[model samples]
Target: MSIKYKFHDPGAIYFVSFAVVGWIDVFTRSVYSDILLESLTYCRKEKGLNLHAWVIMSNHVHLIVSSREGYLLSDIMRDLKKYSSFRIVKEIRESTIESRKEWMLYLFAKAGQQNSNNKNFQFWRQDNHPIELDPHLNMFEERIDYLHNNPVKAGWVTNASDYLYSSAIDYEGGKGLIEIDLLV
Candidate 1:
């Protein structure tokens, strides 16, 4: 892993992205995505995650985030991924309506078996690919725009703010599913 992608400055905000293993479209169902949303909410309330903006796509998530004082961004991200992975994998395993349950579980189990770090399954890819943002460099707006417009770019919605799984609504002066620490 390159040091460039690592979280070096705890106070500096960062743009991060993590995808499901194999880029599987697991989040096509709201039930699964809701698990992620709940986890993000929990992290925000309890883990000191300063979430500025975010989006949940079909198989991945993007965020502009940092840690509050006395918290480490890396630690928060690790716990987020670890908890979400376990919950999402368990949900898929136990879901009676998940048509692709067996296939998804098989893939996760295969990925886990191939990787020495996992014991049973690997739901999320290991790398967060974090990019630290310098607050003084006028990067927040650009990143937020890019993050919010992801669904629009994908043709899922005409306007970014219309996407239900993103913080674009908050940016548009509407409350979203989760709270956001707005960045100017």
Candidate 2:
């Protein structure tokens, strides 16, 4: 098998995006999204994930991240995805409020069966599509803008900063849900 995106530079920041299998809109519910947030928080605090910006859409997540001095961004991302997938799938299995619980679980199981890497469920697609950002070339502004404005483009909010599931608010000089290492 061939991989499209690779984490070549260990110290460089990357803009990475990953989606749910079949592009399912699993994050439409706050419970599922909250699980993702919790996982990200854990990574940031314990796994040396240096987050610059992030956004969680209905089916996917985009993050601008790097690793701390002794950590690898790729390793951090792998753990984040693994833990979040297990946690979210468990939530779906036990949730009393999820309207699409059966359907979502069935799809996840089917996807898992097809992928040899997973034994039961596959909540997230494998590729992060990590694109390293060049600090000297002013590439961050463009990626950050694109990441922040995703909710606006999706018609979820009129203003990007008004969206709660993103770092847009933090960039606007307001506090966001998770801590971010603001890009300069």
Candidate 3:
């Protein structure tokens, strides 16, 4: 879908997702995932992204986050996608393990054409569908639980808190391995 709405507001809760080109399993490696983690770190520490919840799936990412420091969520997403897009393409080209690189790139090109007037590659979907969250306690808790349980529901892990890549542990009042800004 075309990005019709440019969400530049800081205090908005966004539940965003970006699929891999052709829904390819590009996040099968630790390196790409590390890049995502690094982006989140940069968001929290530098860009003022206050993450309430997030889950890294095989082909997509789900994040419920907002920024309080007047930084736009769209800008944060643009930087992350641009950086990860280049790295992922480079890795696919160089790594012998990436057998599906050609097919994936082809599909990305197709999607980009369908989605926009992009010429080369499109790593993530352009639209980041952000829903404004109510400050009520129950609604906040419910969404947080959903984010944490996503990996467990997908059968990737036995327990929600066991998934180190997610914010489940942090929501459960434990120390998360990836440094996250405490939900604001």
Q: List the candidates ranked by lDDT, beginning with the highest.
A: 2, 1, 3
Q: After superposition, how far is residue 160 of candidate 2 from its true place, in Å?
A: 0.6
TM-score of each: 0.96, 0.96, 0.85
> Model-by-model lDDT, in order?
0.90, 0.91, 0.74
Q: Best to worst by TM-score, what's the order?
A: 2, 1, 3
lDDT, residue 75, model 2: 82
List model 2 lDDT by residue over 109-144, tens digit each: 999898887789998887657999997888899999
**Poorly placed runs, candidate 1 (over 4 Å):** 1-5
Query: What lDDT, from 0 to 1, does candidate 2 have?
Result: 0.91
Model 3 stretches astray by more than 4 angstroms: 5-9
**Which digits, one per residue and each the tens of the lDDT, describe model 3 over residues 125-180?**
76556666666746566777777788899998999989967888886789876866
Model 3 C-alpha lDDT versus the unseen true structure: 0.74
lDDT of 3 at 157: 93
Q: Residue 99's C-alpha lDDT in candidate 1?
A: 93
Candidate 2's error at 171, in angstroms?
Answer: 0.5
